[model samples]
Target: MNINLTLIGQSITFLAFVWFCWRFVWPPLLGVMQEREQKIASGLEEAERASKDLELARRKAAEQLKEAKEQAAEIIDGANKRANQIIEEAKNAAEAEGDRLKAAAKAEIEQEVNRAKEQLRSRVATLAVAGAEKILSVNIDAQAHDDLIEKLAAEL
Candidate 1:
């Protein structure tokens, strides 16, 4: 065989192989690479969106926590005020009860004093009648002198 003819045949075969690869195999490979690149870009965008959503959730949770703390403070303040009001009411009720008891005791003491005074007046009238009968040397008829005895007892 001629060396030049063999070299030319080899060169033509190499060219045909290169063209086939470019038309068929290379197109599919390039398509796969572009599809992978697009998928990676979309995944990066989704990750960025998820990060923003997480930040927003954190802010909302912080706001809710602040509102809850404020509501708790308000509830505590209201409870304290109500406790103070109840204490004042109890104190007033106790004072009123004490005053009523004192008044009742004073009235009872006055009634006892009046009863003693009445008993003493009756005893004094009886003693005077006995003395007058002994001095006059006669038994005094108390029933007959009922009006006089009653008048003298009233004066005593």
Candidate 2:
């Protein structure tokens, strides 16, 4: 073929190839690229939203942990207070019981001392009366003895 003829055919073929690309290849390729770009943008937005939600969940968990610690401290404090109160009450009751026992023992000791004193007085009085009767027995007539005995009995 001649150089000029070959050049003409090449020009026609290039034009036809460009026309085919514009009509069929370029439109679908551009559409697919746009769709891929939209998908990537939506994915990035979803990831940002998920990150925010995760941050919120972490904050809530931290708050719950703080609340749990406070509650545990409150419970421990309450138990300690109750135990102290119970111990104080027990001490008071023990003191009261000791006082009552001491009072009762003192009363019993006093009663025993009084009883012993009464018995000694009765024994001494009986001995004195018998000694006076023996000493005065020979000096008295019958009527006088009777009168003296009546007097002594009255004195006793």
Index of the highest-TM-score prediction: 1
What tens-digit string does per-residue lDDT give for candidate 2 at 1-156? Answer: 457887989899999999999999999999999999999999999999999999999999999999999999999999999999999999999999999999999999888888876776576567656755675674646676677667755664
Q: Which number leads on lDDT?
A: 1
Poorest 10 consecutive residues of model 2 by lDDT? 131-140
TM-scores vs. true structure, each candidate? 0.69, 0.60
Please report how far candidate 2 places residue 113 from its true position, in Å.
2.8
Candidate 1 Cα misplacement greater than 4 A, ranges: 1-15, 130-156
Alpha carbon lDDT of each predicted model: 0.88, 0.85
Evaluate model 2: give its lDDT.
0.85
Q: Give the TM-score of candidate 2.
A: 0.60
Report the lDDT tens digits of candidate 1 across residue range 1-156. 557888989999999999999999999999999999999999999999999999999999999999999999999999999999999999999999999999999999899888888887778767866766774576557675666667676777
Pairs with backbone N, CA or C atoms under 3 Å apart (clashes), candidate 1: none
